[model samples]
Target: MWHIWTLDDWEKNIDLERSGHRCGLRLRFDKEVDSEVRRACKEFAVFLRREYFFPIRVVIYVKARERIIAMDGDKCCGIFWCMPDDYTIEPYIRLAAGDYEKLCKKWGKDSALTNILLCMAHELTHYFQWINSIKLTPIGKERQATNYADYVLEDYAETREHP
Candidate 1:
């Protein structure tokens, strides 16, 4: 069972009052997740939203399972679901913590938390592209998202190192 998250549920609502994007972030996590995973995601979501404005309000659902079938029926780390024509419908990003851990091990990521940030960054990039009406072939979009994710992670690393 899922419910709207609150300040008592691990992370406080991100203070986007001055962001000027009229955006908000809502998060829901399955009961199976540990606090560590939730914390990493919440923190990274804040960083993403602050650095790259959300085109609209967004919800992020972190699933417990290791894998999920995308609309195309392919297993993936995460997905950004949106209908380009209907901005009124709140878009959401779905990520699986188990899959993040597995991918971290498989791809030699620094850690699962880092993998989580990278995957979410990828999905968020897709969200931006969708809202901005950027058209690309499927492969091209994937490449762009991948590049954006890398850039985000690198930028995040810089912030941590300097601050």
Candidate 2:
């Protein structure tokens, strides 16, 4: 069943950086999620904050099939929204937990989390572009995001293997 959540429904919120009055890394997970999955996601968010800077919030919806539709009206794994009022509003990301689970079953937990992390990284790339005023065509943006995600995952693997 689809359970809509308000800002108050955030259970996995974290402040990545708080230099002054800026908010950071507001993460939310559905109440029905497994503890293991929740832990992994939280840890990954912290890792992302450390590795890069972008996006102020992330919401992961549980297997609510209809609730996580993209702008094209098709079911999507994730989306990153860039607010119009850049100075007053910050970007945020949303991910589908169902897709994460499917990847886990097919690729094992760590690999699946890696995939989900790639999705998050892709969204993050958009935020990076938005903040830096980097302009690109829609196709160029997607290609860049995909390349960035792959670069991130490769770097992560190297860190794990060497460190």
lDDT of 1 by residue, 1-163 (tens): 4211111221122233543435666689998875777877777767766765554688888898786679999898899998766655678999877765566568654566777777877887777666666679999989988888887888787766321
Q: What value does the lDDT take at residue 138 in candidate 2?
A: 91
Cα deviation of 96, candidate 2, in Å: 0.6
C-alpha displacement of 143 in model 2, angstroms?
A: 0.6
Task: Give the alpha-carbon lDDT of every model.
Answer: 0.70, 0.59
| Collision pairs in model 1 | none
Which ten contiguous residues of candidate 2 have the minimum total lDDT?
Answer: 2-11
For residue 64, what is the lDDT in candidate 1? 87
Superposition error at 86 for model 1 (Å) = 1.7
Which stretches in model 1 have alpha-carbon errors above 4 Å? 1-22, 100-109, 161-163
